[model samples]
Target chain A: MKKPEPVGAVKHRRDTVLSAIVSQIPYIRFLGVSFDRHGDELTATMAYHPDLIGNPMLPALHGGATASFLEITAIVGLTWASLWEDMEAGNIDVGTVQQGALLLPKTIDFTVDYLRAGLPRDAYARAVLNRSGRRYASVHVEGWQDNRQRLFAQATGHFLMPPRDAKH
Target chain B: MEDLADGMAVISMPYDEALIGDPVTKVIHGGAVSALMDTAGGAAVMAHPRAGVGTATLDLRIDYMRSATPGQRITATATCYHVTRSVAFVRATACDEDGDLPVATATGAFTVIPGKSKT
Candidate 1:
């Protein structure tokens, strides 16, 4: 357990850990969320599918899907911050594992405004960090289809961060 | 009937059996209405062929004007009004088949992502 081998020493560790965790999340995988880093922003995109349809008469996108997208974005934002901070502290190895634990303990207090009706077409969402602290973070996420805005969801979530076990 | 329009969609269902509460005999599930609003708004955004891959709803707020009737056909329409670099804003309304008055209204924000397929 040599102090988890310093963060810098595990440059690709965050990605590996995230990939593994994301792979096991069926709903997320089904949503086809792909992650990319742009400076401080982390973006997630998913294609529209029939499975996410809410109303058969209208064949529109489901609000649950929209909420799910927002939730995932919030999780990613928190994880991103955790990983970034760990890397800065040269303690990256614990970031992912710690993130997984925190994610399980996190709760969402989301507020959404249904501005417009979404089509049966594809859609995507992006989460932006509004603020972040030691135990909590707030994010403003938006979802779109074609080039228009379909849903706006935001939340401030609190995550319990505990130190990794001695095994790490 | 006017073509579904760019950001418009219709929903007609039995309110009696579909709803959950007794106080409101013809109670439309809030979730169901929200879903309809999302679809309409999403479609409005995707109306343009050149639009990006797809969009996802970030948040939605709905205000119920009045409860709908049981076994009645309801229509919902959503339109995307503004779109910034990464954010899209939309507004919507739901009503019965006659289109006389709105049963509910909603507003939402959506984020557009590049390289994704439209739903």
Candidate 2:
């Protein structure tokens, strides 16, 4: 009978997968973005940096930074969602993907709603997958600081899904 | 903002690895392009001939047409198409080395500073 994989190996694989996913996205690293994962769900964080400011007169975070943060959240969140089922079935093994990095969805359109001025502070966001099909997907991301209920900005993005048959 | 005139503005960002979205393709992220377009739109609104003071983005929609070439600076131009008592509308586009082909196009609404003159 085949034996179950040990817990340590499973944890190592998970860590490797996560690192490979993030490190491969240079923009996310450049923006100092990080993620906290719970199963298939992800919450992204961007710590405030001086370079993040666009209008220093108002001392507000650059709208672009906020927008980028939200979009990356959605993309990475979707990537995780795609991987969850395989991981659950014990099919996710690190160093197997010939694609080198996690396959990032291509953005077709993104609409951002700037609700409030982004203050100079750490920001948090979460992405909700509105719908995903074989060739198209939509995601909504909301960003906030200090309070989760009061969002500083939100975005709805539609993406073109990569071919599923393309080996992972 | 490199240049600003009546109802128009232009901005550009040089290519940097830090802004790259696709590690494999080395293409800049749509977010970076979004930020550029938003800033350009706001600049256009603030520079409008309608006695603008300050402005805030209410909503901005961007449609990406193609991936930007790696290591090419991106430039965006925005035109304030219309204005009202409390809002301004802007249309903008971004492009890279292939200046004729736009990387993305955007339309946005921005809040206009209150108190307009009768003239």
Candidate 3:
């Protein structure tokens, strides 16, 4: 008989899922991405650095960087959801999982629209999972700068999830 | 961007630990590949027949077929396929050293900046 899971336990489980995916991505660390979780929602913050600037005239954050950031957010969100599902089904234990317990999600296709120049400052992104199936997941993501109301980019992507034992 | 023959611009990204998407598999992140392709697309606009014009990415779409082999030089080449008064269409491919098949293919449009008359 499984007992009712408390809110804290659920949050902790989600954090484990998020970290498991985030820790594997070297580019995420290179860009200084920090994650924040509130009630089940995850948002990523990218710290500004000189190496990320593309347009020296405007001293703006590279558009490519903005797109990548938002895309990563989407992938992370979906990976978290997938892991959580695995936990609920009693398939895997989040605590004792090894580094390669889950295969990295592969991007099938991605589209990015640059709404405006990414200014030289911290950028924030959040991904909304649109749909998830056995083999594929679709996500919509957006990125904003200082003001959340103003968007810097919008992206939509599809990711392919291979079987656990299959090689990507 | 390094100039290649036939009006192509190429950008090379070294394989480094900082680019790995999966530490266990050592796969390069899709974002890094996207960035490299985007940069190549913008460079293609700069190397267009009507050079000396600044351009910004309007939209970029990438289709990833496979993971870039780890510990190999990733290179992206961009070619400007079409040009209009206000927009330039570019296509790019990112591949590893083997170069038999592209890891990803990208198509993008860029806003063209007017340059001073060469006359």
Candidate 4:
């Protein structure tokens, strides 16, 4: 029997880059962000606990949680995309690269549209790469809670490429 | 009715491991700082002479300086900058036992729900 073909190499590289990024954000480690990749997109899920509650009467998931969730997703998505770019360019120093070099494109503006209220339960977010270019990248992220959609936050992030003479 | 001259009300809570972002490292989460800011902002509005007015956060921006350690008592002080016919602007900061450096700084905008008296 022929050996099964190896899974897509890009995905394997993406996961490695993502795990590195998550490890840097200690808060994310506490929040328990789990990452899963699908083709070019990535999804992250975080479980909410009682300590994150802002309003006891309403039991609303604090907006800060929502903000952190969005920020993490953006960072992860950009890191994943940069990994692919580095691979295509035959650069192996991606691990030591700074965020500015990896995000080559800058996010000029973004918005988050809260669709529904979140409960003290698990929250999910998915980041989709809308466009990736040399100077900028756009990503759309949506968050869900208790199986209901809660937020739609997008980032138009810019990443600065390495300066000429810098070894990559 | 609580007097307006009392200045913005202050509330503080002891930091705990749960507030720490890393269970093992004991670094407080930035979100926790933001939450404390939000709570302080709301309490400042509620402490105003006007009671029964609901306040919802419109926008909040926080600048993080350093992370708080677990088991440190965090004191939050909120000051109401202005209260218009419908909007209230507030600023707050969080400090630990040392009180020399701020862990986080935040500013927020709140809108008073309809049919509520300022007093």
DockQ, all models: 0.09, 0.82, 0.74, 0.16
Chain B TM-score per candidate, please.
Answer: 0.74, 0.94, 0.90, 0.85
Q: Best TM-score goes to which candidate?
A: 2
Q: If ranked by TM-score, best first, what sequence of candidates would result?
A: 2, 3, 4, 1
- What candidate 1 gets wrong by more than 4 Å, as runs, is A1-14, A24-26, A94-105, A148-168, B1-119
Better of 1 and 3 by lDDT: 3
Q: State which candidate, 3 or 4, has the greater DockQ.
A: 3
Model 2 pairs whose backbones collide: none
TM-score of each: 0.48, 0.92, 0.90, 0.62
Task: Please write out the lDDT profile of model 4 over residues A1-168, one tens digit for every residue.
Answer: 966546776555556666655665566765667777666667788777786665676777666566567656765666566666565454755466433233222223333343444577777787667766554566667787655443533223233322334423
Candidate 4 stretches with Cα past 4 Å from truth are A1-5, A87-90, A93-116, A126-168, B1-32, B51-54, B63-76, B84-86, B94-104, B114-119
Q: Chain A TM-score of each model, in the order shown?
A: 0.69, 0.89, 0.86, 0.69
DockQ of 3: 0.74
Interface quality of candidate 2 as DockQ:
0.82
Candidate ordering by DockQ (highest first): 2, 3, 4, 1
- Judged by lDDT relative to the true structure, which candidate is superior, 1 or 2? 2
Docking class of 1: incorrect
Q: Per-residue error at B110 for model 3, in Å?
A: 0.8
Q: Provide the global lDDT of candidate 4 against the true structure.
A: 0.61
Interface RMSD of each: 10.8, 1.1, 1.3, 6.9
Tens-digit lDDT track of model 1 for A60-140: 657656655665666666656656655546565655454443332133244565456657776666766677655555666
Of the pair 2 and 3, which is ahead by DockQ? 2
